[model samples]
Target: MSANDTAAANTGSDERADFLQALGQHRHFLRFATRDLTDEQAGQRTTASELCLGGLVKHVTSVERGWAGFMAEGPSAMPDFTAMTEADFAKRVDEFKMLPGETLAGVLDAYEKVAAATDELVASLPDLGAAHPLPKAPWFDGDAKWSARRVLMHIIAETAQHAGHADIIRESLDGAKTMG
Candidate 1:
């Protein structure tokens, strides 16, 4: 193969590995965000605007759907949250702050289901260079559309941001050190 072909091949491999690694870290943080916390503690919110462990679990599900749901629909992308509104969204997050008598197992089960769906979404799209016609980012204006690669990257960035929230919440719950 020519040098150009070799470079292309290497880039392809790197993209694949990078996607997997990024998604894996998101999933890992999901679990770590709950470590050593009792059910009540995991459900505690640091403030009115914050996410509890359960909320992060649900938001991750929401984001996975948003980023990967309409790979074929492009510009029409944005997940079929057909009737969901910002209030509904906040409600989902609030649900994580369990009521008087909810169990950790219940929360874990919800997260596991969401994670399974997320893994499938990631697996379904192995190539990032693939293009879709989603509206361009605000910075790029509507002139440019996002590619499959950007979609995946968007997910990575989204999850990493929330994972930081999870880490702080987890630490507050159990006094777990910031690092292992």
Candidate 2:
């Protein structure tokens, strides 16, 4: 390969590795946020909001799955948020709540599995530049689009933001701390 080609290849590998590293760091913090919490504790809404450690894990997993699906399939693959009924909205709301019989351990295990699958998908992606139109939503611009790489970065940001939220919830639960 020419020098320019070799530089471009290294850049891609580095970018991909950076994305994985960022995602993994937040994922670790999330696990730490739930550490030592029992099933009931994990489900408790310690904060004013509905967020909980187990719930955060569930939401993050769902977010990752949705975005990864968009990357793999296209915008057409995303759920029609606009068409959701009251029942559908209620179900989405409940997705972030750790219901009865749901164990923190179970949620954490599933989160780990999702993280592994996401890492595999990112590593195996053929072209990060593959583009797709954004789904129709109030928050999305009508003309907006994103590349697969942008989707990965979005996941990183989403996980990191939720990790912070989880830290606060965990702290409120029992004075536990995930980070300084």
Candidate 3:
């Protein structure tokens, strides 16, 4: 290959590696770093907030789906669960209604679905710099817009943060340290 071709290949390689690293680093925390507990164990409200392992999984699923809709479908296409559902508010509730014999398996399935869909959206995006307005919601100060890149990184950050929370909750559950 010519020098220019080699340089382009190197840049492509680096970008691909960086994207994978970002996905893996956050996903590692999202999965094992904040998990491995029974429903009862996960349900324990260690804090005044209802933040728990299961709840974090649910929250992230909702957020990830919301971001996917924003980046892939535009803000007008959907509503953030946080905004649409008002009957239950003023607490970080598990909100996810699981059926009988429902293991963490269900939570994992939902999160994986969202992650896969979101990953595809990120990969196919023509430009990470592409911007879309944030859905109108109560949490913000004013009308806001987010770039496709920001949404992807935000998922990474949000999941990582909650993974930390899950770490604490999991630790509190059985005096266990992280596997990761």
TM-score, ranked from best to worst: 2, 3, 1
Candidate 3 lDDT for residue 100: 46
Residue lDDT tens for model 1, 14-104: 5655686887787778767777668777667875556687667666766666666645456566633445679877766565466566666
RMSD of candidate 1 to true structure, Å:
4.5
- Alpha-carbon local distance difference test for all models: 0.67, 0.87, 0.70
* lDDT (Cα, tens digit) per residue for candidate 2, span 12-33: 7578888999989998998899
Q: Write candidate 3's Cα lDDT for 86-177 as tens digits.
A: 54453334353333465566778888888888777767778877888777767744568888777778877887787788777677777776
Colliding residue pairs in candidate 3 = none
Query: Candidate 1 has which clashing residue pairs, if any?
Result: 75-133, 75-134
TM-score for candidate 3, residues paired by index: 0.78
**Per-residue lDDT of 103 in model 2:** 89
Task: Identify the candidate with maximal lDDT.
Answer: 2
TM-score against truth, every candidate: 0.70, 0.92, 0.78
